[model samples]
Target: MTPLAISANGPRESYGDKLVLDGLGLEVAEGTVFALLGPNGAGKTTAVQILSTLIRADAGEMRVAGHDLAREPDSARHAIGVTGQFSAVDGLLSGRENLHLMADLRHLGRAEGRRRTTELLEQFDLADAAEKMASTCSGGMRRRLDLAMTLVGDPRVIFLDEPTTGLDPRSHRTMWEIIRRLVADHGVTIFLTTQYLEEADQLADRIAVLDHGRLVAEGTAEELKRLIPGGHVRLGFADADTFEVAVRALSRTLDDMPRDDDALTLQVPSDGRVRSLRALLDLLDAESIEAGEPSVLTPDLDNVFLALTGQPRTAVDPPADHPVDPLTEKAVAR
Candidate 1:
């Protein structure tokens, strides 16, 4: 088995009056994307804070990038980069300057800093806007710059908390491609926390759902989807007459198959297995009901999220004027 890049067991944390993380534990393999999925106030950020050494957990043991997070926080810090929900770019500085600032903080010498800065500007496609003030860059450009700055230190692991939260579709896709490249090309381990179910389904090698400060589910996307119950087979018809015929003929075996009159489609509940599909097809063939096409519809990450968390897969925006948790703000700002 591949070695773990991140491992934490029995992590606990609390706010002044309420417990936030209740003995949450997880493991992430090296060079893979591990997504922490949760609704708002589910302690996703809190877990990030603890693992990144931003906050001291009430009790837990963790190793990040081969360094004990508690005993060697500085070593762990050196191996990790963080991009939080908010942009960390310095608005007054140019993209190139932002990278240079990070290199300097990492103690890279003048020539090396300049070389790394130029390299990152080109890699992130920020060379065109390298000299432009970050304040003038588009949201997508700024995000790229932020990530480029994080790479200046050559971190082995990166924590991205809602990195595409406010981006447009195009920008979101751009970020996803970059994230994939980070793992594929650079062998970086990514710890992503997001409320976007599709993002987790698309990017994560493994996913864990956090609810009420505890992990309710963890698995590959397909495995988690299997935990939910609503998979089905959808059959499209060339005309309404065929759809009605199939519905009536299958009614004896399956009850209440949903039909879309306008689309001429019928949905039958099934496990989406080959045997089930074969049986469905045989019955349809026997009845002489010709479907235009048949598609096996399995449960998606949205269904898994809802089934595990008992919450809809909706974005829960933070409250206006919400006080920023100081520990997270401090860690992510660095």
Candidate 2:
């Protein structure tokens, strides 16, 4: 049987009279990454909160890790881990102490806690900095410690909310690799929310775009990019004379050709495929028009997010008491 890590239907939430999530529905499969992408205040965090049992949805049928979110929140909580955008490591604690603290909270015995702590410190490359205070650690080190702490319970599912927002490029890539390893090696399901389009592209097996509290689009990265209309091939020439000749010859042969004189380039609409490129090359060859090297311009996640969600991805500022940590009392009041 395929294990479902999270399932929800018609989830609704409101703050005062403002409805945040309207009929929001989702289902995440085991051992895969499900990325949630959205603009600020689009209820991405709210969705995570509800699924993790940190908050209650006004109305919904929900289950997480085989536990009913509304009726058995404690059971649901025991089955999942969360690492949010901000560093959850206490500045006063050493990296080793932080992991040990989580092990204690999970009720692991002295011997077991020590073993897990040592293993995670090595796994997260914190063995060298095991005794370094979190305040003295680099951004990457803190983030890794935060993740290591989350793994103490060995939850089958994890929710990572913008987990790499402030890390350096190399650090961000390292986190990506760690996330992949967790899913592949441990068979853990990951539910990720992030403003970084590149992060979603690199990690998510499937992506859902939320706009105005509703799921506006959902698909694989390539499938989502295909929705936009501007993907095409452009041909440039050294001089205007060849460009004009190519345009006159290829005008009827292509769909959309926006002629540019100063740059001596003719834009031709394309589906961004090898066959289409070959056809364009053959047409140019047949016409005997000297054309510059052909290039394919396909829409990326930035273009797709804008076209589909009508908004740009922006970092969500962490609330004063960020809820990423296990010890934090961030559960929403019922």
Candidate 3:
């Protein structure tokens, strides 16, 4: 069994009278991406802060990197790295200096710090700008440098809050590849919160949706899509006779199966799962009906987010009590 890198049960928090998190609980396995998604003010940032040891929860049991949050927060911090929505690069320092500063904070010796800084500079393609002031780096370069700083500590788990907010198309995809490699090559578990629903679909192994300080839904992307309506497999028929037969066969199994007489097609509610498609084929085989290849249509993550949250993913929430964690932005900066 894989050990859990992060876990929380009945974790609750409030800012004065505004309840930020009401018993929000979650578990994240080692070497996997777990994305926490929500509209603004959904306590997503609060959850990140609590789990990453930047803030205290009002009540509950929480552990990160196998260390209890209450008793061993420093130990947990040693194994965790955070890159918030804002860049953490110190504008005064060069990219290389920024990384070396982070390594020094991790207590690495000068030689090891230099070696790691050099490796990350090349890995993140920042070697070209290694000697340039961080303030002069492009948006993508700054984003890359920010993440490189996070890795200087060799953290087992990372919390990323909207890591790609200002990236362009090519840079966005490049960052996605880097994220994938981190899990596959380094076994680093990621806890990500992003505005892009497609980012979750592309990168997350599991997703948890938060609304009003509570979990609304949790599952794989496809599983969550199944929870919404308007998913079906459209089976086209050779003739009216076969269309009627297919609809009659599917209607018996699926409630309110739709059909188009003029188009000679029947729509059976099903997701993109292979087993579901195979079962539909078995049913057609039982009836000896010759239905052409079926086309499946299911709601995407955008639709799923809207259906579950009662608002679009980009919609802003009511005024939240979120304050930027300066330490999280620059965990090792002096």
Reference-based lDDT, each prediction? 0.86, 0.85, 0.86
Off by over 4 Å in 3: 252-255, 312-334
* Residue range 1-334, candidate 2, lDDT tens digits: 7777788889887765667789988888889999999888788888887788776777888998989877888998898999876677998989888888999999999999999999999998997669978999888988999999999889999999889988999999999999999999999999999999999999999999998778988888988887888888888998878887888888776656887788888789987878888988998899898887888988999998888777544433235244443454233333
lDDT per residue for candidate 3 within 1-334, as digits (tens), equals 9999999999987765677789998899999999988888787877887888777777999988889988998999999999988888899999999998999889999999999999999888897679999999888889999999999998999999889988998888988998999999999999999878999999999999998789999999889999888888888999987887777777776788777899998878887789989998998999999988889999998888888888533422222234534654211212
Instruction: Give candidate 2's error at residue 53 in angstroms.
Output: 0.9
What value of lDDT does candidate 2 attain over all alpha carbons? 0.85
TM-score of each: 0.85, 0.84, 0.90
Q: Rank the candidates by TM-score, best first.
A: 3, 1, 2
When summed lDDT is taken over every stretch of 10 residues in candidate 3, the lowest stretch is 312-321
Evaluate residue 305 in candidate 1 and report its C-alpha lDDT on the 0 to 100 scale. 81
Clashing pairs in 2: none
How many clashes would you count in candidate 2?
0
Q: For residues 265-311, what per-residue lDDT tens digits would candidate 1 score against the true structure?
A: 88899877788899999998988888866899999888788778885
Overall local distance difference test of candidate 3: 0.86
